[model samples]
Every structure is written in structure tokens, then in C-alpha cells.
Target chain A: MNAVKKIVKAREFTSFLFLAGLFLVVGIINPAFLSVDNISACFNSSMVYTLIAVGMAFAIFIGEIDVSVGSTMGLSAAVAGTMIQNGSNWFLAFAVGILIGVVVGLVNGWGVAVMKIPSLIFTLGTNGILRGMMYLQVGVEQVNSLPKEFKDMSSKTLVGRFTVYYCCAVLLTIGIHFLLTRTKRGRYFIAVGDNAGGAELVGIPATRTKVTAYLICGVLSAAAGIIFASRIGIVTSLSGNGYEMKAVAACVLGGISLSGGVGSVIGAGIGAVIMASISYLLVFMEAPSNYDNAITGVILITIVVVDALMQHRAAVNNRHARLAARTSAVPGGKEGLEQ
Target chain B: MSDKTPKLGGQNGLRRLWNGPNFRWNLFLLLLITVECVVFGATNSKFLSLTRIFASANGDLTFWYVSIFVTFVMITGGIDIQSCSIVGLTSIIIGVAWQDFGMNIWAAAALAVAVSVACGALSGFFVAYCGVQAMVVTLGGSFLYSGLGLLVSGLSSTEAYKGISGFPDSFKALTKTKIFDLIPLQMIIFLVLLLAAYLLLHRSKYGRKVFLVGVNPSAAEYSGVNSRWITMSTYILSGLAAGITGVVMTSQLGTAKSDLGGNFTMTIITACVLGGTLSTGGKGSAIGTALAAISITLLRFGMPLCFGINKQYLDIPIGVLLVVVVVGRAIVSNPTVIAWVGKLRGKGKEAKAGA
Candidate 1:
């Protein structure tokens, strides 16, 4: 009973419930959505978003944002896709893609952590530079005609009805969640984000931790890019155009606090599923695909507003309780309070 | 002491003027503008033509128009990525109202501005009252408003690709008419707006309150300032500016489309930051923004004309400029770096004495 209660009280549990409720409601509206194949497809398709959102969660955990993630992803995908289309070794292409991620992460880390530039502004600067470079390389051309086996690799499943990508992502999220919760050094991210000065006083290397967080974020986003190229079989200059916003939204939906130092990769993975499945669910509901952006916006605003209001109410109630406790502890409380 | 005061009066007076509010920054911007003009003019004689310069400046009014009011938003330590979407919303509203409803063009414009202001107020409420991050709220607003713009565009009989054109000549004259046949009317409008922004931001009590709120919100609240309202009002001003840009752009281009300002999100922020507005808030000036906008406009104009670079490649230079200028400013202002420099100078002096 205690274990169940703890599970119910977990922040990620709320996101899980939301996801389940969404699925139930959609299934009710369209029975076809309830099928095993379609349900598994939703999870399988969320692989890219899952990786991106988890990466974004790392940045948010350290109390900063990286608006350049989309551009980084685009550039990496363009590089990997172009190389693969040119008949290069897959491993070499993947290595080059990850190398691009490392370079971007280092630059972003140097600017933001070492130079102390605001992450948003610095990343936005890099975002523009990367986007320009992408344009220069692609020049209005899309990288296509990828190898058939590579494209077919996305459909390869590891377990019953679950793609290898989705299973690995879930396991990775769980492993990271375990490390973050159970390990001492892994908790440094939350500590620095919660209070940087306090963390430094306690001998944590705050700057290095922040750089590591951004590094992990960049690596995950690049991995997502490689997966994206394989799944889509084409890489346009606009491939990852607005994924940054969606990833942020996914992180928030997953119960991660934007203010930082709170949440888990598991929640982020769950949130990614919800974000990724929106358009797929919309098709079942017979809604116009054009409404996708509007719906995402509405959902984002609604969840955030509701969260704010709940936090406000909790704060008010806690204050009232503290006041009551103080008053009740005093003998002859009214006279004591007056004194 | 009395003798020193007299001896130092002239030099101190000059120093005080040099150190005056935004004086150094404004002078730097002026120097940059002059250098750009000289280089561009030297490269291409046609770039020196007054008529051509005015025309190019007039064409880029969409940027500075939004920057003027966005500077107010940034001063309050909040950002509005949604302003570009609001610009799109305003354009589509004006187009739909004038074409489909057959309303007067001016009335359509007024309605559009009102609606845009409401959009700003909504996002501001979320950011200020609900304590949501400005970036998130504005990002969501960008998506919502752009989607709404598309929905509105669907109401028009004209196809989305074609856009709504055939605007009245009288309405079109807003951009076409020039004062003295040398200066574009848009330039005059820009000057007036710049003056208005300067007065509102630098000379008004409300502006001081905004600065205080941005500098320290809880303290501002304790001091009886309605910080939330002040923050929200800046966003409204931003929305109003975006609406004006929408109308001006439509008049300038002789058409209205849902995506009129689709690609202007970064350029607007760049202009503000390049002008010395702190992205973290509490420090900015209107003159700095205007000068920055003009310099950037000239760069964009000159790059294609003089170097034969494609307009598409402009983002590279602009991005490099933003990163370098901001990072340079950070390094210059950093206390540790200052102390390091001071130490190096002291060591040099000590070595000289030992020698």
C-alpha cells in the first residue's frame, strides 16, 4: 500500500495519468486507435522526440535553456544524411555526426559556462550560425536516396511490437533516472540548479557540472538527429526547424520545472510520447493537420496555467498551516499573539 | 582642495560629459554607422546616393518599428518572441477586414492594432501574473497566433499564395510620399517614433518604475509599484508596435499576407540587443536601439549591393556580430577581467621602478 501510495504521489505519475487519459479519450473517439499495432506505433514514433526531450531536460535541470538544439540537430542530420547518401560507411557518418554535436556542445559550454554569457542569447547566436551553415551546405537541396537497409532499420523491433529505438530509449531513460536518484555525483545537477552558490560552497564544481549537462544534451539531440535521418530517409534544411520549442514543451508536460532542479528523465520520456503522438491522434479524430500547432499551444498554456495555480494554492495553504501551528503552540494564543 | 577643484574643472567637465548616460555607447554606434557608410560608399558609389539610402532604409522599417517598442519589453526583463506572429496576425486582420468585410482601410488597421494589443496583454498576464517564464509563454504565443493567422487567412476569397492586394492609392501613399523629395515619409515616421520612445523610456516616471521593477521585482513591490502591471504594459506596447509594423509593411509592399513578418523573430531581438539593451533587463536606451537598427539596415543594404553576396547569407554576419559584440561586452564589463588588467598594469609599473 505504501509503495503504491508513493508511486501515486510521484510527479511522473501525474504525467503518466495524463498520457493514459489522453489515450483512453482518443481510443473512445476512434476505436481504431485502440489497436495494439497503432498503440505500439505511437511509442515507436516518439523515439526521436523522446531523445530530444530528455536532452532538453538536462539543460533545464541546470537552470538554463538551449534554443540551438534544433539547429544542432539539423546540422548533424544534414551531415550524417549527406555522408550516407554519398555511400560513406554508416559508422563513419554516425561518428562525424556525434563529433559535430561534441563541437557544438563545447562551443555552447564555453560561451555559456566559461564566458558566462546568457544561455538563451548565446545559443540563439549559435542557432543562427548553424542555420546559416546548414543553408550554405544544402543550398535548397534535400539529402535523399538513403540506403534501403538503413531506412528499414527503424522498423526493426526488439520486443513484441516495440521498435529497437523505442526500447533502447526507454531503458536509457530508466537507467539515467536511476543514476540521478541513487548516485552522489549524479545529484550534482539538481544541487547546482537548486542553488549554485550553495553548491559551490559545498565543493561541487558548478561550472563543470553545467557544461556536462549541456554536453549530454547536445549528445542526445545529435543521436536523435541520426535516428531522424534514418526514419525519414531525407534531410531538408528545415528538418529540425522548431523542435526546440516542442522539446521544451515536452519537458514541461513531463512535470519538469522550468525554474530547474526538479524532475526526472522518465517524466520527460513520457512527455515526449504525448507530444509526438498529437498529430497521429489528430488523424484518428479526423481533425485537420493544420490545427496541430494551435492544439499544441493550447495544451501547453493550459498545463502551465494549471500548474501555476496549483502551486499558488499549495503555497497559500502551507503559509496558513504554519501560522496556525505557531498560534496554537502558544499558551493563551490570542493574548500571546497580541503581546 | 579648492585649488584642485579649479584646476580640474575643465577636464572634469569633459570627462563628465563623456561618461554621461549612454553617451559612450551612442558615440560608438555613431562611429560604426559612419564607418559602414564610408566603406560601403567607397566600395560602390551608388551606395552613397541619398535617394538610394533613404529607399533602403524605408524598406527595412519593419525591423526598427518593432525594435522601438520591444526595447520597452526587454527593459522590463521580459521578451516577446511572439511579436513577429502578432505582426502576422495584424496584417491578416487588416487584409481580411478591408477585403472581405469591406471596412475602411483605416478602420481595419485600428481593429487589427486593438486585437494585437489584446494578444500581447494575454501573454503578458501569463508571464507576470501566473509567473510563467516569458520565453515559454512567448513561444507558445508564437505558435498560437501564427496558427490563428492561418485560420483567418482561410476566410478570404483570395488564395493564400496570392495574398490580398489592390489596396487604395491613398492608403499606399503612407509609404510612398516623401518630405522634400529626398527623405522618405517612412524615415520621418521612424524619427517621430524614436523621439516618442526616448521620451517615454528616459524622461518619464513610469519608465523609472519599469527600471526599478526589472532591477528588483520584490523590492519594487514593497516600494508600492505595481510591478506586474508595469511588466504587462510593456508587452502591450510591444504588441502595438508590431501592429503598426504590420500596417506599414502592408502599405509598403502593396499587399497583405498571413506570413508578412514570418522570418523577423531573430532580427528584432538582434536589433534590441545590438543597441545595448540587456537581455536580462533593467538597462537600455531608445537612441542606442535606433542607431543599431540603422547600422544593421545599412549592412544588409550594402552587403548585396557592394560585395554581390546573396541576401540569404546575411544571417552569418549578423549572427557573428551579435555573439562577438555581446561576448566582448561581457568580457569588458567583467570585474575579474578588470582586476586582472589592473594587476598586469601594476606589475609593469613595479618592473619599471625596479629597473
Candidate 2:
């Protein structure tokens, strides 16, 4: 009974358990899987996913989803690559890339907030349009001539062990933590998600708050695109094709609900780690590489189920704990219970 | 009552246009086709040739046909992004069972449809019973089914990118063979499907129930309408349509790729919206959606052929068109414009009376 109680109380804790167990299994299958070099490689590749997931957290927190982030990322990279190829300085190129992201985010927010179009449809259209633009502008031609400094982003080792991108991930997590918990805008963002109408009643501008959330999401997504381009050392039209789904999956795994208003920065960061680790662990098991995508699908479904059950359990536990506290405090409460 | 009855007929015929179930928006479709013909002909004389038009129409018809079914799904306030993945899976299942395993083609097709319908029902169950939002459930579904499609393709001898070919001649005939030796068999199939959908969505009792359910499920429930069944059935119908379209597409292309129907979710949803189906639900038309699909299919093939522009840039025009139509609708609703137009007409009438 106590074991059952323990399991119900610790949801994310259980996810951590499952994630660790996966690594253990992989280590047993192939001892090389636990090697520092391979682990470092996983973190390096995952830095992009982590960046996008954190940005997506803000949008999901504000009761919206940006399916166009993947395309926005792709579009930004294309813009950056094209500008750089045209002899623009790297800084100016990066700025142009980030600007494209902001423009796409603003259009999305306008459609949703001002025009009152549903986010699902509006984002779907934008995703298609932006993706088409990326393909047209960049074609399938890979950009391979990036400056050495940019390419060094993923290659640099920090403290003689961890990759520079991993350090960036840590810094991003801390920054997001400060932005989400310590800031006034972050509180209003949460308030809007929790109940938009109630927040509006209390004088919060829900539309502007939602729009700002998307703007931050857009900027971060573009930054992730830049990192991905640097890591790969080339830009392809396919670069950001499936990434939006991956980022969303990571956020969901990290305890972010699609309905919004609930999640944590640290939890989402861990979620990114868990997902990136899954791919590495599977490869080590000598499992057919083809099964990796299927495994991702299965894991995503399982996580959502577990999250739902955990939410249900938490609700029940809080009710029970409140009842116990009330009974203990009230005079004759014990007598009433006995009767 | 008699006085009001006279007034009804005394009003201008144009006044009834807005109140009519099928209005000028429907008529606007014909104008677009005429404009397309004239523009394309002027730009490229070859565009008016029979073979070019037929080839383009044949290749694009299946997608538009399938999108017509999505119009129903959208009307019920549900989306089925998984339909794209389902199309791939169905085609592969048909290909493997019939071609590789040497099973009966009809039986394989039926099994494929069953698989698709079952997948749709699973999505519906999540939405109806578990209280999950339809968009999230379908988005997850798109990932799951697409992954499943790749796995199924891997099981077959055909490479994932190369796709499955060598389908039976009769199956190919489903898409390529002509009805009157002129119209492609697929277009005929599309027309028949459109007619069926038109009757199902407009003339049937259940159709009315679907609109009610979408408009207000709680109120519908109180009215003793089985909103759950209505919602679930739309998904099943959507699945069936996707499955059939998958079979037709595979036949038409002479191959089955896991990504064959990839990127269709956006196109179908766009077609639905371009037809003026409210994304929030309770307002849609099969006829309007079908016309929109036709327009889109023509635009995709016609623009590049006429202008000699890259096909990839076509998304710009389509996106701009969608925004324009939506914004135009909003502008039409402004009271100031309507009143100003009315005053101008009234002043003109007074001058005519003086004359």
C-alpha cells in the first residue's frame, strides 16, 4: 500500500526512474554506451532541442501552441545563410535571422489574438507558408562555407569535458527560470493561461501577454535554428522539418500540458535531456535504427498517459490531505469520524 | 401577414442574395475558373491544351477529393491531421498484402480501410471519452501513424524512399481509365464522392445533428442528440475517405511511398478554410469545399505552367489568397460601408425620380 502511495506521489520522479533505467539497460547491452565521448556527443546534438523546447514552454504556458516554430527556424536559417553568402557580417546575418522569427511570431499572434482565428489553423497555415518560403529561398542546396567561429559553437569543450552548447543549455535554463518565476510579465503570462477571462477581469491584457509569449518563443526558436546550422555546418530545407514535433514532445514529457497553464522550466529542461538520451541509448542497444522513430512515438504516448494519471493522483492527494488537516484541527472532528 | 408577404417580394433580388443558403460566394467560384482560363491562356497558350489540363487534373484530383471529406470533419469542430499518415499506411498495407503477399486486392483494400477507420475511432475515443482536445490528439496521431507507416514500409522489400510499385492493372484503372474516353476515372470517382457527401451533409437527418453538435454539444446533449456518435462518425467517415484516396493515389502514381500523402494535412485544412468553413465549427458546406479544392488544384498546377515560375513559390500566392478572402469577409461585415453604399444608391434613385 505504501509502495502504491509512493508511486502515485512521485510522477516526474518516476519519469526520471524510467529514463535512468533506460540508460542502465543500454549500458548493459553495450558498455561503450556509457563512454564520456558518446554522452558528450548526445548533449551536443540535444542542445538545439533543448533551446526550442524551452521557448515552446512559454507558448504552451500561455495556453497556445506554435506549430510554425519548426518552419520559422528553417526560414531564419535560410535568411541567415543567404545574407552571409551575400557578404553580410555574421552579426548582421544573425540579426536578420532573428528578425524573420519575430515577424513570423507577430503574424501568428495577430491572427490568433486580433483576428480571433484559432491557433491550430493559423499556425498550420503559417507553418506551410514559411516552410514553402524556406524551400524556395534556400532550395536543397546545403550551406557549407560558414566561418570557423560559428562552426566552433558545437565543437568547443568547456572545463575540459562538457561541450560549449551544454554550457549554453545550462545558462538558458537559469535565464528561463529567472524570466518565468521572478518577473512580473511571467506571472501575468501564467495568470492568462490559468484563466484568460479571469486574468482579463483583473486588468491583465491577455492578448498582449499571449503575443509577447509567442515573440519570446519565436526568438528562441530562431536561435535554436542558428545553433543547428552551426552544428551541421550546412543549411538544408529539411533542417527544421520535424523539429517542432520533437520540441513539443520534449515539453510534454517535461510535464507541460497542451491545455496550458501548467509546467516548469527545470522539468522541461530535464525532458529534453531524457529525449536526447533515449536516441543514444537505443543506438547503443544495437536496436535497428529504423525502430527509433517508433520508439519515440510509443514513449510520447506513454508519457502523456502517465502525466494524466499523475495529475489525477495529485488532485486526489491534495483533497485527502486537506480533509485530514481540517479534521485534526476541528474540535469533535475525531468524534464525528468515529460516529 | 398579407402586408409583410407583399414586402418580401417587393424587395430587390440582390437583397435576398445575402440571406440565401447558397450565395454570391458560391457564384464567385465560377468567376475564378473563368479568370484562371483567360489568364493562363494569355500567359501560355499550351495551358489551354486538353492533354496538359487533363494530366494536371488527374494528378491533383485525389487530394482535392479527399479534402472534400475533411470539410465534414471541420464542420464538426474536429481535425484529423492523422489522415495524411493514414493515407500512406493504407496504400502500403494494400501494396504489401496484394502485391508482395499475393492476397486478394479487394480484401486487402477492405483491411486497409478497416485499419484507417480503427485509427480514426481511437482518436475519436480520446476526444469523446477521455476529454483530450482534438487538435493535440490528432497531432500526436500524425506522428504515431507516420512513424508506423515508415515501419510498415521497412517491412516490405521496397525501399522507404523508392516506394512500392507494380500494382495490378485493374487497380491502376481505378485512377487512370476514362469513363467517356475523355474524363479520367478518378475525376468521375471524385464527382460521385462529392455527390454522396453533398447528400450526406445536406439532405440527411444526421447531417443536421452534426451541425447542432458542433455548434453546442452541451445543448445538443440536452436536446437528446447523440453528440458523441455524431462526432465519432465524422472521424470514421474522414478515415474512410482518406483510405480510399490513398488507394487511388498509389494507383495513380504507380507506387506507394510512406511520405506520399505527407504535407496533406495543411492543404486539406487550407482548402476547408478557403471555402469559408469556420475553423470553430458549425458552418461549412461540401459544395463550397469541393469548389475550393478544385481552385487550389488548378492554381498549384496552372501558376508554374503559365508564368514559368518555380513551383515552390506557389505557397506565397495561396497563403495571401487565404488571408485576403478572410479579410474580405471581415470588411464586408462593416456597417459603415454597407450604409454608405445604401445612401449613394438612395440618392441616385431620387435623381432618377426627378428625371
TM-score, each model? 0.94, 0.88
- True-contact fraction in model 2 equals 0.27
Q: How many backbone clashes does candidate 2 have?
A: 0
lDDT of 2 at B178: 72
Task: Give the C-alpha miss distance for residue A109 in model 2, angstroms.
Answer: 2.4
- Tens-digit lDDT string for candidate 1 (A1-339): 999998899888999999999999999999889999988998999999999899999899988888888988988989988898899999999999998888888888888888999888888888888888877767677988889998998999999999998899999999999888899888999998888889999999999999998898888889899999999989987889889888998998899988889889999999999999888899999987767777777788888888887889999999988987889788888577667
* Candidate 2 segments exceeding 4 Å error: A1-18, A28-31, A85-87, A274-278, A305-339, B1-18, B21-24, B330-355
Candidate 2 has a DockQ of 0.38
In model 1, the clashing pairs are none
Per-prediction TM-score of chain B? 0.93, 0.90
Query: Mind giving the per-residue lDDT tens digits that candidate 1 earns over B185-266?
Result: 8888888889889888988998898888878899999999999999999988888888888898888888989888766788
